[model samples]
Target: MFTKKVVVAYNDTDLSNDVLDYVHEILEMHAEIELNIVYAYEHPLENPSPFQRNYDDGAPEMLAYAEQIIQKAKNRFVDLPNHVEGFVYDTGPAAAILSHAHDHHADLIVIGNRGTRGLRELVSSVSRTIQTKSHIPVLTFPKFVQEEFEEEYHK
Candidate 1:
């Protein structure tokens, strides 16, 4: 099936870049496609410790950072003919991406699987949650898998 609208989950991480690299390959095949890049970030002080109760929430800074990253992501597609747009949300990543995809009627969701293990995995596995919960088709690119693809492509 032809994919017209795609929702991409980006957060300026290496894993997220891997997803973008894969998306670049997809763009080569689909000449007419619309990309909606979404970056969701949470406030650093959302769960501040008791000792840091008076610290500024830094929501504005975080949002600004998110916007910068989204802008950089948009720049990556600037030369391409496909339409590209970026979005920044002050919320959880998985929830924001799913909601955005649904709201925009996206045909696909492209995300990077961080492959975090142990405690970190339980605390922050956005790709897994998104894949399971999203009604739209989800494409996940793990870091190792991307590396392998690059290696093969160079050979």
Candidate 2:
């Protein structure tokens, strides 16, 4: 009767891909697990590039990109017996993750951490905030793990 409802707060980062692979490995062992793969994207306030003519144009593109990432993750684990759902939100990553976990009653959250500093701190704060504010368990992958995984994959 053991079960786990996991929320993987994924971005397009390499570390996030590694985390997804780890979750896939786990699912190979325990089939009684469910995944809510959520992606949060924040639109930059800056003016659009040559391709994007307006702010509204960029927002839809960002949402589509986020959805694509979530779709790839879902496809990877589609053969599993458990359920897998993908969600995309315009809010901050930490808030989106926490809200999704709470609403879905997830047992744990898996996030990729780069252990950043400087300006990156503003972006990386999502991992830290999830660790602090989440009522459920949180698992984070460090840069070292990402590097090792990358090295192994390239070999």
Per-residue lDDT for 1-155 in model 1, tens only?
47999999998888888788889888878868889999997756666789987665676777788889999999888778888899998889899999999999999999988678888877779988898899988988876765778899988
lDDT of prediction 2: 0.84
Please provide, for model 2 over 1-155, each residue's C-alpha lDDT reduced to its tens digit, 9 standing for 90 to 100: 34488899888678888889998988888887888999988866567677766656567778778888889889988778878889998888899999999999999899988878777776567888899999988998876665778899988
Error of 1 at 18 (Å): 1.7
Find the 10 residues in a row with the least total lDDT in model 2.
51-60
lDDT of each: 0.87, 0.84
Task: List clashing residue pairs in candidate 2.
Answer: none
Taking every candidate in turn, the Cα RMSD to the unseen true structure, in Å, is: 3.9, 5.1
Which structure among the candidates has the greatest TM-score? 1
